[model samples]
Target: MTNQTSEQFWEERYRNMTGQPSGRPTGKLVEFAEALPPGRALELGCSRGDDAIWLASRGWQVVGVDISATALAVAAERAKAAGVSERVRWEGHDLAQSFPEGMFELVTALYFQSPIAFPRAEVLRRAAEAVAPGGVFLLVEHSTAAPWSFKSRTPFSTVEETLASLQLDESWEPILVGAPKREARGPQGQTAEVLDNVIVLRKRPA
Candidate 1:
């Protein structure tokens, strides 16, 4: 198995990547954000920048971070083509070593998992702290493996389980938390039912 934690592994993956967009930003991001006013936003593991670009289009100044330089390059180009380059920035980062600077009105980690072990809980703790006063941190993750997935990751934690582990302070309010079923196409266009664990939290203003 490839060591996903190493930059070289991701660099190679992105370098070999050849595909259309990673599909449009999920309805989840648009639905949760459309109601809220836009401001600075941060997206972790922002692979091909779909969600980040969508947020930029919605008038947020977005900073997207990924470990692969190739991925960041692609994201930058995508933002440019969308005519939202001025509203978004892409950074190459290994989350365990460092993260982008500055607090944000919204911080998100969508499907942020890896085959290689990672300090996901600690990273999310920092993600919570990165939210500015009155800001929101939205987490969306797969609750199970894809029907055809070959990667052997353990079943993902439920929304309730992840929240319980976060151990957030009283300053945070849970806006929404649940695992919902959705229909989706696999890489080969086969149909599958997938469960998504979604959690949205808002930080109380100081």
Candidate 2:
């Protein structure tokens, strides 16, 4: 199997994709971020920049990181068309190889899972480290994959399991950790019940 974490693999995948982003931010992001004040935000695996653009529109300066250069280019164009081009920046990196620099007031990894093997825990730990003091780190992962997903039969890690892997210290305050069920819409408009492991943490201010 080709390494799914490689830049080439993701670039190929994005190059074949059709249409633009849905323009709707994930429900979890909107729910949690709406109350917080605007600040620098980092989005890990920002596929088409929908969520990043949404944050930018909300007065937050956003840095969207993706593994696919093609996706970044398309997302940048979409951002420019949205009239929030100055609020968002795009970068391409293979998380297994490199990560973006600087800290952020908000760091998010939503549905950041792959069908193939990868160093996901290590990447997420690095993501946690990028959160500035008193910043929020939100992770939403698939506890139960959607029917159309490539990982449909794969066993998912629970909230406890993921937290154990993260090895967060007392300096991080857990705001929310649970498995929430939601209705997920598939690519062809099919809907199914899916569960997500949601973890929201805040780094203690110095």
Candidate 3:
């Protein structure tokens, strides 16, 4: 298991892992954001930068952050390859220690779970605080374990729990907060049904 005290764990994981970028954008992200006008965006734990690239391609100036330098390196390559380098900036940050500076129009933490326990809820609260008025904060988490997945068996926090942790007032409007079902495929080409906890909130314009 990886530990937050050791950035090398993550650095090594990305340095050794072999795979292609999941080029397809998160379905939930596309479904909800496709029509929204582009603006500044921030992605937490942006693994290989696919989501950031997608946002950049859509005209959103993006800052993609992760703790792993190797991962950010690959993400930088992808951004360059996609010709969106000018619009996207890849940043390395141990989010548990600090966050990227600047407010954003759209903030996301898609599948940002870590094997090692970290201050995720607190980080999320900060994420919300960084969202500009009229901006959106999007969170997508796995609701349950998949048969083919290798993730920790830790139970996922519910949308209600997550929302509660933020302690937002009426100034924030909940767009969606519930677990939705979806079909998924395993590495072996096996299929199964899974549920995902999705939360979308927009801050009321001041």
- Each candidate's root-mean-square deviation in Å? 1.4, 1.5, 1.5
Give the top-scoring candidate (TM-score): 2
Tens digit per residue, CA lDDT, model 2, 1-206? 35444666677778888866788999999999999999999999999899999999999999999988888998899999999999998998888789999999999999888765678999999999999999999999999877787753258998899988998999999999999999999889999998899999999997
Instruction: Give candidate 1 misplaced runs (Cα > 4 Å).
Output: 2-4
Q: Per-residue alpha-carbon lDDT of model 1 for 1-206, expressed as tens digits?
A: 56445587778877987776774997888889988899999999999899999999999999999998988888899899999999998988889889889999999999887766778888888888899999999999888777786574666787888998788999999899999998877878898888899999999999
Superposition-based RMSD of candidate 2 using all C-alpha atoms, in angstroms: 1.5
Q: For each candidate, what is the lDDT?
A: 0.88, 0.90, 0.88
User: Candidate 2: where are CA atoms >4 Å away?
Assistant: 1-5, 152-154
Descending-TM-score candidate ranking:
2, 1, 3
Runs off by more than 4 Å, candidate 3: 2-6
* Error in Å for residue 70 of model 1: 1.0
